[model samples]
Target: MSSVNLMAREVAAKIVFYGPGLSGKTTTLRKVYETVRPAHRGEMMSIATEGDRTLFFDFLPVKVERVGDCSVRLALYTVPGQVFYNATRKLVLQGADGVVFVADSQAEAMDANRESLANLEENLLENGIRLDRFPLVMQWNKRDLDNVLSVEELRRELNPRGVPDFESAATSGRGVMDTLKTITRLVIKDLRAKRIVPPPRPAPPPPGSAPAGLEAQLAQHLHHRQPPATTPPASTGSTAAAISATPVPRTLTAPAPPRVEPAAVPVVSANTGSKVLGPTSALAPGDLFDHARAAEAAFIAGDYTTCVTACTDAVRRAMAFAGEGSLAQQAFLLHVDGSDLLRLQGLSTLPQLRVDDAAFALYVLMQVFVRLNAVGLPTAG
Candidate 1:
């Protein structure tokens, strides 16, 4: 389960590493701890035998990324993989938000892989979680070893549902970060789908506690302006730089009377980069679409701060056009979860926006943009 610590304004989730004995669960986590910046990760705690076989569990806490005002912290654990440790595994599985099933890929370890997978299913059922609905990723570890089973064969036996899987050799740190990033994305997507929002608190983080370089990056492009339809010139650099350099706001002065019926929005393929949705036969071209498009472009350019700011503006304008008693207004409220938009202003933490959050914000804005086009008046030429 995801825990929203209201007082702390943090959303922390537990992701466990599970596998058969010596399948490299501990190695996977240790690699992650080493790869992550020292400032963003906690000390790794391991309970192991004298030979270093995990006797209980190993834990490492890391703040992977953020969404909106909510900082996302991942409590990563590796359950002891020995057969007799099934009871301990169940205990570690408690309140887990996600799982990474690491399988030993040596040809001789096939039976062990099946047994561990079955054990995972059984434990999840005991916890009242349906195996089909849980967020899971599979890692075929020890791939570099001789006589390893093919990834396809391993998938057929262990990942019948075809959950996201990766090939790895934990000792070399290959595929370690890939597996972590995949699981994090899956966990966050689930959280957003369930509409879990963690309000931001005013407490200042202790030194070196924030996501590395996130705060500093956000500070550079805190201010943003609405962009013109075409891309800016070469001497001007990025869209964010151009916007912040001029600091001008573009306005559509047309007064909006309450729209009794929604306007008809044209669907523009998001895959087509730098293409604007032009004026429809009856209505003028949508400015909101341009903003949304700009947000997408900024994100592609790695300017998440401007992307979020433009997305926020696009959503705000869409809400204004949606009006009361409109379907679009209702959808916006449900998507944004009450007055949260008011709190999202500025780039203070916006620069730290994760890929999932940026994609979701643009999705919401596009929804409203489409609705606005369905009901908007024709703009003056």
Candidate 2:
């Protein structure tokens, strides 16, 4: 089953890569793990025979993106492809959100592929998901092998349902990312089609009290702060009716100024080894603090991308000025509700982020910045 953690605003789904033994399921998974940024993926684990044949399963956890304000994490597993491991495969297939049936393209392996496909259908049925309706993708692997069947021939035997399929040489990293991306898209789309329920929100916080911990500090810092008058106007991005500064679990509110781009703010991440944007000019810690305020304002006005970008700049600047492992960074990471410099490092690995996702990321990051600079920070208009 897909797990939705309301308090954390996180959604986790399971995806299984299934195939006959030596069909390249594990190889495909290894390719994906190698390609995904380290910060975005958990350690890979495999239980296999001494000969390297999978005896149980291979597991990798990947953080993909946000869906309707929930962070999506995928637990990718590859069942042992040998027929004797059918029980293990059936157990792993339980609650799967999607499947990638990797078929070895070698002509001689056609019987193995057909048997595995039939086994997959049986297991899926036992798990209460109709094979015909489940989110599935086929990977015609080992395409580079000289003794391989054509894609059409493989499709005729292994992919009669005409599920989306990919041709690949998993060992060489050929089409691996594309195959994974397609399956992810299909799983997300299927979840949406099934109308997976969003996690229930927490009750509203009391008036004038910050949402505990770092939020309290943030509210204190921005309590007397307000936006500047000369700020350029914005398109009125996704605005909430009111700003909630109370002690709620996930409060998102800030006073937005008219949207204008801030100076180039450069931020370097220690965790992910990525640079955050900021101003070129050497600014004091106080000056960078003001940028954090501006970021909050942008988030309030629904300029999430800018808000997140500015918040990154602010954190980086603060860290640089205060030095790494400073009180500021520690305080923010300890108390803030959403993303921090370290956590955002992994999210930055996401490719081609959408606007809402950017906004959500920024909104959370702003919270972190606010908490970090709550004590005696510079004020922004």
Candidate 3:
């Protein structure tokens, strides 16, 4: 995945290129990296080794915008093409959205192609994901070679299942993007077929409004989506009144919110390479530290709501800043209950103030407690 267009609101899906040694797998990727604009890509991790160049593999996190009403995001990744690193390859396959098998078309590399195919099958089976069931495409890489295998023979002997395969001169970038599009089309088709996503929920109709249909529909909708365990289902509720039109009621008073938080040393991580901020140094990308400055300011400024909003946005923006579950994310999630959303009673979003350059640890602790204490808000929103 090379790009995320927020305007279009398409989530990027993770796709990986896999094949045997010298099959132009890495070359195909390098060409992609060079061809795509810098903004479309992420930190490309290529672990090179002696036996095979891509020791770990490469990651291109791209997002595809939906032309539809609501936008969704998909995360993408790739596995190392080397044979001996089978374990690492399996790890990459975990949670994979799609795969591209770059098979060599040369007659001389026939044995390697077959071995890699077998390995792909074995590894996929181990992961409890059937290769045929997943969104998969096969690439006959290096077709420009002098003595190449005929497409028919390659199909007959190699592709028994008869998937949508491509003939590609990956070293020169020919057919590379076609392969990408094929996989993308397949993934989108699968997502559509799954039907897990519902139509966009329109905002609640204004109070005592005309077109009561919208209000009635909205209430029924929210009730149906409720946790089932906590809230009554559709059968019990008659009209919108029983349904939640706003957030749930909270104890009129949450304990006199924290006045002060603990102080900790800052942490900074240099290798992964990203900006640093707050009392904690070495914080991970896509994770946030508590806005001590914001909290302190809110308290001093006598605006607890702003302080709360500051910390809540800190956690969510951090998640959007990075993909899923980078360590910092898990910690932040645990800190903020499962969902990172926070809304103060009778208050709009609370704004935040910046903190010192090295206060990440302190930031984290503050966020943790704040989120933990703010759980069980009405899920109506």
Candidate 4:
């Protein structure tokens, strides 16, 4: 699965490195992580069992080349390979946009490689993905080891579909990048084919130019009308009448009062769950901003339930405005909820809805509003 964030100008896809135990799935991921520029890579996380084998998964987020105007971000994961960890493997394999089958090249490990490949297919099926049609790359690993199977033999055994295949010794970093590059390219191509990421939207027109369609109509509707010509006062001798008849300068209008900045509202911290001051800055006009403000007010007024409700509405409206087929909507679906509003509704029902919970919800909602506004919301005619 893939997610696009129009606000961030980023397209993210999941790529899983899968193979039998000791076939270098984790090592390959480490090599790639180390090779990537520090500015482009995030912290790598690995969950390991007491035996030092990966207990759950190893994750590395790397930003690669641009796909149109959006930078491509790849989340590389490796599933636990031990036989007993099959359940964990399947869980990690879900929503993978592409895969790299890192097969152990040692002749004795052929059976393990076959079993891992079969497991990959079965798990992909459970996720409703067909391996044959999916984007896949094969890496015949441990080529430096003795008693290793030939590339021809490995391909014949594992890569029957003949997807892009590479020969590598992951421990030495040989061919690691080649395998990664191929899988990434294939995954991006697949995304385009599936229309998961539509073409980069045309750039907005230059500022101050009359926009087309609904925007043009909105511009015209909001344009200020020129004031009608004022009649001069009839020749009055009074000082006040003379002052008025002198023809007031266009720049002499009364000055507007200074704006009063709102005090920062108290909200819960997302990471620590402690009370923190919410941003005092206002969001642009939209349903999202309105809902966020309502949530903030509810939190300040000690109405936890109402705060939660407003936060939920904010997410719902943000998702709706993001619309279908958009990266923003897909992100909400992937990371937030499939039934967009249900999760938030559950939060409102908690028996002792603490201030922290309500404040956190409002804080999250405000963050969403800020992001949507940063991207410039679509104007409604």
lDDT by candidate, in order shown: 0.70, 0.70, 0.57, 0.73
Off by over 4 Å in 4: 203-381
For each candidate, what TM-score against the reference? Answer: 0.53, 0.58, 0.53, 0.59
lDDT of 2 by residue, 44-124 (tens): 999889878988888999998676656789999999988988999998998899999999999999999999999999988
**Candidate 1 residue-wise lDDT at 362:** 59
Per-residue error (Å), model 2, residue 40: 0.7
**lDDT of each residue in 85-189, candidate 4, tens digit only:** 999988888889999999999999999999999999999998998999999999999999899988889988998898999999888999999999999999999
Ranking by TM-score: 4, 2, 1, 3
Error of 2 at 336 (Å): 13
In Å, residue 96's CA in model 3 sits off its true spot by: 1.1
TM-score of candidate 4 on Cα atoms, chains taken together:
0.59
Candidate 4 weakest ten by summed lDDT = 251-260
Global CA lDDT computed for model 2: 0.70
Clashing pairs in 2: 211-247, 227-381, 228-381, 264-278, 264-279, 265-277, 265-278, 265-279, 266-278, 267-276
For residues 66-184, write the lDDT of model 1, one tens digit per residue.
67666678999999889898899999999998999999999888899899989999999999998789899999999888999898999899999999999999999999999999999
- After aligning candidate 4 to the native by TM-score, how far in Å is the CA of 151 from where it should be? 0.9
Residue pairs with backbone overlap in model 4: none
What C-alpha lDDT, on a 0 to 100 scale, does residue 80 get in candidate 3?
Answer: 69
